[model samples]
Target chain A: MKFSVMVNEGPYNHQASDSAYHFTKAVLQAGHEVFRVFFYHDGVNNGTRLTTPPQDDRNVVARWSELAVEHKVDLVVCVAAAQRRGIADADEAKRNGKNADNIAEGFRISGLGQLIEAGIVSDRLVEFGD
Target chain B: MPTVKKMMYVNRRAPHGTGYALEGLEVVLIGTAFEQEVCMAFIGDGVYQIMQGQDTRAAGMKNFSPTYKALGDYDVTRLYVEQESLSERGLSVDDLMPLTYEDEDDDWAEKPSVQVIVRKELSQIMAAQDVLFNF
Candidate 1:
């Protein structure tokens, strides 16, 4: 079955990001297709490469990047939400005149239309949040 | 034509203390471009979102309550407000903004967009949806 995931909370502070990551990983291990993973609200924080967790802890942002690389999952961070939270990519940082960009690999900044389109195409759309 | 999916945006948060309500509304507005069958459900504290006469001046927040009125223009008409939630919060339908839409098929008559229903009824409606986005 094809699935789309939405992560609505930031990493570490909440288990939402962890839950979404595990769910996506399990879906892929079961040989199902992940149509897209749209990050919105605080969830956009997951796309920032600036995340630095304790060395013993699991790196949430890196996990998502690796998932995209290994499974080719479409990981999208909502542009509006990202901008509000200061999670910018190279292009976005330049356009906004920011000093630097922090968007991690395997993720793209986009509009909320991507989330709507994912809902239109995916068989199931699961959300993880507070 | 693309397959029309029944999409439901479920709101469970209040308007201002957090960003969920605003962001959720953003998604609903953007979703209209996809030409999908879209509807919104206001449950729990979410019913407060459409409450009439919301003033954010003192709070220093943008008053987005007016944007709900413009949903009709985007072809988003159905807004289900849970009746029980209203009573639980000591509010009634009258407390909500009068959101309306013009029906082109019916000589452009203006009609109410918010429908007050019981939780049981809302649950059935949710089960029928192809996608449910909760905030």
Candidate 2:
């Protein structure tokens, strides 16, 4: 089955993102396809290149990046949500003249329409939250 | 047959604390607008979103509990609350808004499909979906 997921929580502050990663891994191992992942609300924080957990703790952001790269999944972060939460890619930072860029690779900044499009295109949409 | 994405939205926080619930409803409405199948489950503090008579305006934010009633307009009728969450918080069905969903005008009450589910077995709901959203 083709899957599309929407993640709405931050990694360190909430387990929603971590659980989502585990669920995605299980689905992939079970021979299912993850079509897309749409990140909104605190989920957009996963795209911030600056999240660094304690070395002793789980590196969830890195894990998500690795999983996304290995699977070639479409990792979409909502632009509106990201902006509201102060997450910015190079283009956004440049446009706003911020000194640094925080959004990492393997994640695309998109609009709510992508979320709607995911609904139209995917066989299912699942939510992971607080 | 073409793949039809069955979407599930997980709500984790309660209403009035943050914008999570309202924002989540927005996504569901948008998802339903595209004619996709959408299901929602509330967990942890998220169960509070469905609680009746939420007032966030005192905090200087928009009062959005009204939006929950509008969900049916986009065909979002399924609203699931975790059994464990309710028990953990000592909440009762009566504490939540009437299971009845209202149309856009609020003139008629459309009873919502509400369920109380175990926490551990949540994966049963999760495993069946093609996509899941977390909020």
Candidate 3:
């Protein structure tokens, strides 16, 4: 089945993000297709390209990027949620006059409408939040 | 025959810790108003939402746990609990908000059509749903 996974929790500081990562891996291993992974609310933090976790610990940002690359999944971060939380891509940073760009590659800053679109096109939509 | 839209909502946060849970509840209410079938699953900290006692005025937030009781009125009846999360928090089935409880069964082959799972299990559970919304 085609799936659209929603990540609504931050990457670190909470188990939610880690859980999201492991779950994504499991889905892929089970031979299912991930149509997209949309980030919203605090989950937008997963898009930070500037994050630098300890080399020893699991680097979540890199993990997500790798997952997207391996599976060719569409990783979209909510534009409104990102800006509100200071997660900006290069274009968004320029538009907003922010000096820094934090959105990691393989993830694009988009809108909630993408989520709605996923609902319409995908067979299943799974959300991980709070 | 009319096909009832069964929407399974999974809530993962405490009642007042953030707005995701409440906003999610609102969506479910709206779904019901639109004649969609809605079921709820509380995993991880979301179990706190259905706890017997909640006081929000102290936080200057509107109290909405009462709205939970109204879910039954909306025809939202199924509420599932993750056995691991409940056991981890030392919570028993009795501590939840007067809902039926289901443990993680070993037989994944005969699992419920849909399930509410913890953070670790979310991806798999989400893949199974026709529509999954996480808050």
**Which regions of candidate 3 fall more than 4 Å away from where they truly are?**
B1-16, B21-132
Summarize candidate 2's per-residue lDDT along A1-130 as a digit string, tens digits.
Answer: 8777878788888988988888888888999889888888889999987887788999877888888789898889998788888888888888878888788668888888798787667666677766
* Candidate 3 lDDT, B64-113, residue by residue in tens: 88787776556665666676778889987667555322333443232222
Number of the top DockQ candidate: 1
* lDDT of candidates 1 onward, in order: 0.95, 0.79, 0.73
Would you list the rank order by lDDT, best first?
Answer: 1, 2, 3
TM-score of chain A of 1: 0.98
User: Model 3: which docking level applies?
Assistant: incorrect
RMSD in angstroms between candidate 1 and the native structure over all alpha carbons: 1.1
Clashes of 3: 3
Error of 3 at A57 (Å): 0.9
Please write out the lDDT profile of model 1 over residues B1-135, one tens digit for every residue.
Answer: 249999899999999999999999999999999899999999999999999999999999999999999999999999999999999999999999999999999999999999999999999999998899999
Predicted model with the maximum lDDT: 1
Which one wins by lDDT: 2 or 3? 2
